[model samples]
Target: MNEDTARLSLKIERLEALLAVTKAMVTQHDLDKLLDIIAHEAANIVGAERASIFLVTSDRRALTSKIAIGMEETGLAFSIDAGIAGYVARTGEVIVSDDPYGDERFNPRIDEETGFKTFNLATVPMYGTDEKKPGPLGVFEVLNKKDGDFSEEDLEILLALSGQAAVAIENARLLAELRLAQDKLDRENTRLRQRFLKEYAFENIIGIAPAMTELLSLASRVAESTANILITGESGTGKDLLARAIHGRSPRAEGPFVALNCAALPESLLEAELFGIEKGVATGVEERDGKIAQAAGGTLFLDEIGDMSLATQSKVLRVLQEREFTRVGGSETVRVDIRVIAATNKDLKAEIEAERFREDLFYRLDVVELCLPSLRERREDIPLLAEHFLEVYRLKSEKDIKGMSQEAHDVLVSYTWPGNVRELQNEIERAVALAKPGETIGQEILSEKVRAAAPSPLRPMADAVRALETGLIARALKESEGNKAAAAKLLGLSREGLRKKMARYEIKL
Candidate 1:
């Protein structure tokens, strides 16, 4: 072949060799294996006798070699200030020397320790991704070129290999770090799930009051059956918690327990959301099974059932009466074998009288009625609930708080919790977030409204007429545990009239 053709052939072979080296390096994921591959490839590409890959230690004070081909020992560490490789790393410069003994920067200690003789070598700095001012990642060095001395071409080829090596090293390191982070996150999620199960277990329901005891006993008895249940209580009462408890204790404990609030969805979408939908039912709709189908062999909890529209209620009544439902815009009668547990804060009896709700639906749903006492009615359980919530939030916030102080306990018990158990839970969470480390939550951290809530004083009568009205209302609400209907009846006023008076008096629920 002519000189030009021969030169072209050599260039093509070199490019192919470089491509092979890159592909090999990319295939390796293990850091030690990749480093060894990079070292061996660098030596082979440059026609060198041996090669070593050195990485900067985390402290940046030394270079550590985990992989060194053509060496007695694989692991080697040296100070960055000591040897020829160290000099290249520190200065981020390439070094090509025909005689290593002639160089002042060449340290003979490693050679003596390994019982290997040092000769001609080319050292190249492996740089990180930042091009503006590249940082030294490590050093790649090869010793004793096979043909003769280390040449300029050998240095250039080694430099190209070292660049690929640098990127592969960074990628391997990042992948290892991500795996470790994911493992940590997985462990934390498992811990949280176990903690939730332990905290909300049936035995740990917290209330020791006679009323709470009776309610729980009834719930436990009914949990074994497939009978439809209707849970009645004021807003924020633990009706949802009771529903979950029943599901957890049932024969289908291993199955899913799906819950949907009836008041949360619009009337137009409620039917499809509960009973599944067919394609072409509306714009952008997909064929899918809904909550009823999803809750098969499990429990389906319908919360705030009183807020469901008359049309939606009629559909639900059919589900209960006939054990089947038809999806919106479809005639297919889908049958579900789910245990139904419905809850409502509104008086369904009162609703039926006003023609806003159906009487027949009420009879179908009230097969086994369970009434949860409001928070005020069960005031004796406040301290227990507070302690439980404090523990929950303390773990969440990663704080060392022990429990509530005496003043804090007093504030919690005295406040008329119109929002019931849920409101108390929110207050405790807020207190934990604001609490100092290693300290108990105090009344100082409570909301201003809760802090200012005080019982009427005996000597106070700024306006006897207004004072009597407010006092009587507040007393009745406190006695009834914030049950407005009961409080209204006790005061001989309609529910709507009592609501207006409570609003005018700034009585919050």
Candidate 2:
């Protein structure tokens, strides 16, 4: 073929290759795949043995190659002003070098690390559409052309390809960022759901008050130990519930949790109940294990432990001290591996002074004492507990109650909860049961006892009592026909004292 025809055919083939690569670049959105395709196509179209696409980092301090054909691996990086690609990326200029080893801009470390020799290489800056500034995106390079050094035609084709490469790279980068953000959102949503289930579980015990938060923190810490625990609080303060929470948080959560109320049974029955019963020990009684045996490898919670008789306390002390006990009639010694959590509303110290409780037993069970605050002490938690109970009973009763009214919340927070959380829960449950569908709980739905405990007007008690006295005295005078002497007699005050009393009470008569 003639030189003119051969050159024309070569130009046509180069144009077709450019068109095909541009289509391929736009179609592939995956950044890595696009980079690989771009690198290989640039090398093949330029008749070179190696090629690489290096993007400028966000900081613009370095260039990073995501794909480098003929290299052992990719992710090669170099300073933006140090190497040939770096110079092109920094200065936004096309660079062609036949003696790359002699060029001062060439970096030899990359060639040494990758074990590749470059006889000639052409580098062109990839720029975005914005021409107001440098607008350079990266450096695209083809190294060691097979037939001869890269010509001006090859440089022009690469420059055009660099423009298309810039846009495709930017789109792929944006898509990668969006995917990362979506994955983070999905992980956060999953974490929140798990946290809700854990914190809102019936056995988890919910409280936002600082005191309650601290108390639960202590409970979790203590749960790691096998020490005996004494939980002290007023009746209805949920000591039993807290004990269960400790058990659930402990390592023995999968084991049995045996609960027994010391006061629920009589002294004789309590001892037999605690120490188990052998067959024939009682009339028609079969062999049975007590709470201690049933709680082996787990936790045993003794509720109302203060109510237990001294004799029973002695037996309990023996078990705690020796870790061994025998049934009521059996001679076989039964040893147990268990944690004991004892709870009571009564003050054992006072009981000891009264000679009603065993001091030794009290010491045995008081290894770790966790005193639960009364509801009145942690009044800030009332609203939270109320809402929790509201949701609980709403679900239980299949009601549509969504929340509690402000007035209802006021009533709850103002009331002195003598019975503590147990009373609050019951109050909220009753309110939820009585509340209309889709209606919030209101003060009217609360039980009379809670409503009656609402605080009176904020005033000094002395002033309020004096006001009452004045009203009573004035009423007596009106009934006594405004006769001070008659009113004084009715009030059981001397006539002389009557004048002083009337003056103090501010009575007209």
Best by lDDT: 1
Q: Which parts of model 1 have CA positions greater than 4 angstroms off?
A: 2-13, 130-134, 208-232, 243-344, 347-371, 375-509
lDDT of 1 by residue, 353-464 (tens): 9998899999988889999999999999999999988988888888999778888888888999999999999999989988899887888898987787744445646577
Q: Write the per-residue lDDT of candidate 2 for residues 192-292, one digit (tens) a residue.
A: 64564365334468777777788888888998788899999999888888887787677776566789999999988987889899999878999999988
lDDT of each: 0.85, 0.84
Write down the RMSD of candidate 2 (Cα, Å).
Answer: 20.9
**TM accuracy, model 1:** 0.58
Q: Pick the candidate with the highest TM-score.
A: 1
